[model samples]
Target: MTTDAGQYDDQGEVPLAGYAALASVLATGVGAYALVARSRGVRLPERLPPWDVVLLGVATYKTSRLLTRDKVTSFVRAPFTRRTGHGEANEVLDEPRGTGVRRAVGDLLCCPFCTSAWAATALMCSYTASPRLTRMVCGGLGAVTVADWLQYAWTWTQRTAGQ
Candidate 1:
């Protein structure tokens, strides 16, 4: 059986790193949701506005920045992860492999895609618990997201035009 570059199942031991991290994140999200629901006596709304979707998208981008940006990640792991290299937007740090849970969490935090799910859940839960504030925050993020995309589009156009 042909295996992918990162796949290790052919070696008789499958890597549990991703699954473990996902499960940990999911479990934590559920617990947080429960806490919020209990404290606020809130339930998921039957429907959300179209604007809310945009808000969620923006929140995801902002959350990804917070999680994966070098400066932010460095601050998060200052006491644990050691500097290993330099990343585009932040200093890259070595995972705390010797410290089991911290290493796993650091891996998750260092990955924007991995952190998106957590951010989404938090934003969604907050929407139910505090719709007004959530929307305000989301609105700010959504506006930025739109502006960023427009900037990228303009830059691409200028580059392609050979100006």
Candidate 2:
């Protein structure tokens, strides 16, 4: 049952339909990948190497942060979200706007943890289609991730030394 606004209930407004649509899109994407891989005679790897897995994990983390939090990428999320404030490390804080699908998308776009699933899926698909290119891309992202950590460490060290 919905509230008078037709968007809320006892548990408040939950975008069930919107979430389902997003899930459907994800499923469709995976299914398409499988079909394309099979049709192109691509062989699935028996198992991913531990190093490759680590690379993908770092890449996914960085990619997710880039898409969801970076100030430069806010334009992509602006349509579905409203800027509320600035966040740490050159990130923007945004609140999901609108209702239903739009809000669902905004929620996904604003959350690094949520977006990481999509990033990992895309990276895995790329790896399946072209391991060499995927590895290069993952390597670059992984490098950036390390560099970011180092930058933070440097700042922290300076602050500590000053104190």
Q: Best candidate per lDDT, number? A: 2
Q: Give the distance in Å from residue 121's predicted Cα in candidate 1 to where it truly belongs.
A: 1.1
Candidate 1 lDDT (Cα, 0 to 1): 0.71
- Clash count of each predicted structure: 1, 0
For candidate 1, write residues 1-163 as lDDT tens digits: 7987777668634326755866887888889878868887787778998878877877887777666655755777655456676654233544433344566566667667877888888788788888999988888877766776788798789889996
Model 2 stretches with alpha carbons more than 4 Å out: 1-11
Candidate 1 backbone collisions, by pair = 70-90
When superposed on Cα atoms, how far off is each prediction in RMSD? Answer: 4.9, 2.7
Candidate 2 C-alpha lDDT tens digits along 21-125:
998999999999999899999888888999999999999999999998899999999999999999877888888888889989998998899999999999999
Give the Cα error of residue 26 in candidate 2, in Å. 0.6
